[model samples]
Target: MDARWLILADDLTGAADCAIAFRRRGRAAAVIWGETAWDEEVPVLSYDADSRGLAEAAAAQRHAALLQRFHTAGRRLFKKIDSTLRGHPAAEIAATLAPLRAVHGHAFGILAPAFPGTGRTTVDGRVRVGGRPLEDTEVWRRDHRYETAELGAMLATAGLASRVLPLETVRGAGLAGALAEAASVPDRIAVCDAETDDDLSRIAEAGLAMDAAPFFIGSAGLAHALAASAPPQGLDPVRIGPDGRGALFVVGSMADISRAGARRLVAEGAVLHLPVTPHTLLADADGRAGLAAQVAERLAAGGDVLVEIVLAGEPDMSLGLRLAHALADALASVAGEIGALAATGGETAAALLTRLEIRGIHLADEIEPGVSLGLTLGRFSIPIATKAGAFGDADSLVRIRDRLRKARTEGSLT
Candidate 1:
């Protein structure tokens, strides 16, 4: 019960979803950025490296630096990667194992990015999303760093030795022994196959029984299994904040899932859509102010507002970062009026939080699979929910908005 775990992720949503795995299990979990101080009482610490959009070398470097500071004794390490293999998993895995090898004399990383609840599974060492090969998915076609969907090949490209533990081995009774045998070899990483949460739980049981310090690499599914395997500490119940006057929903992703969710919200009449174009955000300061005033007035009138970055035709992917920051800056003027915040994409959430001078978040619960609900820690201490751009369905946003509304009606403010 005294053991601690650190979940390091490439983005904010990844960090929160994984950290919530522990928080939901009666453990104190927090998601923080930079070298900000963490409460020692919390058993789980998830940090966002914010390297998903960076170059391979830069992403690896960022992971290496963060591991140097957080990879301390008595704490288990979990490297949270994208379930669709969108980020630099191979390079980041290498960086995560470096410190372990230096300190423990041997390092074994188990990579299993399967979230069955969300239709992401690993079989034969290849990642699949919604029954299709990852490469065939819209997310991959739009942006993917891997040449192949095979986990072994991806690791091999990064100059790391990897082996696949087939599903038969994963579900067998000898799983613990097989895992121990795999860990005996130095610098060897295994991409374990999993199709269900039970399979992931079996993997967690085996990995936790190993004598050496094992490094975990996966998405929220594996994190949930590992968290469940830990002994309960009887932590305090997490408090969900009550709704303020109204809610502010920010959508900055072009992913199909996010777009659908925005459209669903509009259809349900749950939120008033306030679309701002990139040109106005970048070139027109007064136009930005006008948009902010409109949003604030809506919030003051007790109406939920959904502000999205609108684009005509196909979007230029290169303008994503600039547009995210511009939109976030323009929205900061109404930070005080934002009673509750819901952001769709990681970059948008990070930028908006930075502009609002918020340092960290204490995760309370999960609104749905891959969507996390929490309260901000620093200056803007309000209720917030974060969701990955492509993780949820159309009804996901409506569900989140309804939860915040219920919390307000029930007077659950902490």
Candidate 2:
């Protein structure tokens, strides 16, 4: 099948989650980042721009360059943003519109950044999480770059014109006409309000039916809507079962959800937990080698292991990146023995996979709303699950372990 969709994300977890949406629908989607090149034959391709932590201008430049390189005829575009609006979304959206307008006589974008399964919803052009406004959430307080969570105000800050489609209009019968009319205005973006998967599906259908192909901008929720509406590719989806060896889980995120999940799994005596400080990870060669040997020995004995970075408190942005790379380096040697891999945090996943020489992941299933199960595309083909740090519950890691075990025993990706 020809390439039909191109998804560009600012980080690794976002890329995997969105691509897996299509994979679940048998679209043969694959996610690639870092040095991995594009594959034209893949029906759906998700590319991580790795600009989540960059300044606004740098992030915009990175996305603009990626679009010029990857955007092509007959391939629809999807811009994946953080559900909580943590990254350089406004700049990136403006960058996307400029290039698309230059290429296609007119360019229009429908922004619906809601993933209901993960408790993120857009109401009145503002984001709400778990019945609370985004500004009240811990994530926004800790990591948000923008001063406001108001969608139109955020876009306006970047000098982009935007109109909010209230829930009333989105659910109305004339959504398609409304979207088309909004698109006729140059550089205007439609910020849609949606609270559920069904609401997102309605927005997607309306956008798809327009006379011109609209550029989609949202989270995995929007990706799922588009994937469900996609035509059959007639290509056999890749089915991967697990190997008998033990699984290796890496928790490098500072999110409470991730830490709670790891703690629950360890407290249950399901796996051996090895918690190391950032100092230990960045320690001398012998120290790092010893950690690798211990991990490898556990996996070689068919025992699961959990390797986590224990920070005293939240490190600054630079330290977080350094810590992830250090953790990746410590685990590089045992990467080959990993029968199954699960990682939390996009930067952590990207660093570890790149060190392991994995080119991409052929997605298979979504273990949860923000978690994706897939197999490595290059070098090693082990079963892998990728999850964003803030998503899932205290039992998320336990569920991941159980799911990996079941997949190995059943010899299917269910």
Candidate 3:
């Protein structure tokens, strides 16, 4: 309930841990690790940043040690990614971020650890990934889990305890529905784990929607996804697609599971933008919203539209609300009691239900940290399966997509 300053960073866990470590005595703050900037819409814990190591160092070499881990993270996440990832982490000059250096190159997994406390120590200056020197290009390309480790270390040093929650447990359960018992806040933000730079852009969209509620999106994976269905953005060369649709999330990534899964989501209507606010996703659409307007027009024309939303990105809850509003508006004219709505994608189902206020829900599984997908079927009287940005393999999407398609055709409400 204090004046908490939410810091949008490459990793929310690091941000949270940093807040704990860098506390200035009177401030009450915390971090909500996310999959991407867009997934911030769902506060459900199914989605979690791989905050394995992030603790402020008690030793003088703490910051330097962080740089070493950063190198490995770069390799894990960005190293194996194609040249054009939509939500890749922000470009970090190796020389500026780490210590050992060669020809300076870019790193996708940079921690946005806020300089908390009364005094200030900035990380923006170019540093190197320490430990035996190497050229800039030699720095690890994409390592997401390394970022988690950094967060864990920082949290430990900051004297904060972290608990992992399984988001899958709350599937089909709306935020206000079963979780009403959880420590409630006026607003909660979810972000894509991010594997690209533009993945962080959802912060702008989320900021507009949440207003003063306080939230943002960003992460080591370098991308963000709107939990409500929407397309992937920031695709290279293509900018906006031939359909005039813009490419979404252009981050570097080495995670085969996230890469393949999110790509498919971006192609289907599952990834379309959903906004949130008291008024819904369009909390800020002033008729000038190009993408929303375009999607709306297509829907109004009675066109069979399917939007693909990236669950891996972990967008902000505020943005998810906006995205939900869009999808709901698309279905606004539906006169049916709804034969059976099939919800898929990480936070998509949950964001939609929560935004729609579908009530009566219960978690079927225990919450697991870093695991996406929650399942619940009650209250709302409909089956809801939500993803939280953790997919083990590329085939994961194919399986889920198959299940969703089958459910749609077979009327499998369970």
Best by TM-score: 1
Tens digit of lDDT per residue, candidate 3, span 1-414?
112122332232223222321122222222332222222222221122221122212222432333343322121121111111112222221112333231123211222211111111112121122221111222223322123223223223333232211223222224223222221321211211221223223322332233222222222221222221123222111011112122111111223445566566545654344322323234545532543455455434433233343333443333543454465554433312232233433234434444444432222211121221212223233222333232234444444544434343443422
* CA lDDT of each prediction against the hidden true structure: 0.87, 0.87, 0.28
lDDT, candidate 1, 257-298, per-residue tens: 899999999999768899899999999999999999999998
lDDT value for model 1: 0.87
- Per-candidate TM-scores read 0.96, 0.95, 0.30
Q: Where's the lowest-lDDT run of ten residues in candidate 3?
A: 78-87
Highest lDDT model number: 2
The runs of at least 3 residues in candidate 3 whose Cα sits more than 4 Å from the true structure, single-residue gaps closed, are 1-152, 157-259, 262-305, 309-349, 360-380, 390-392, 408-414
> In angstroms, how far off is 28's CA in candidate 2?
0.9
Q: List the residue pairs that clash in candidate 1.
A: 242-413
Clashing pairs in 2: none
lDDT order of candidates, best first? 2, 1, 3
Q: Candidate 1, TM-score vs. the true structure?
A: 0.96
Q: Candidate 2: where is the Cα deviation over 4 Å?
A: 1-3, 231-237, 240-242
**Candidate 2 lDDT, 299-372, residue by residue in tens:** 88778999998877655556777888888888988976787899999989988998889989888888988999
Q: Whole-model lDDT for model 3 versus the true structure?
A: 0.28
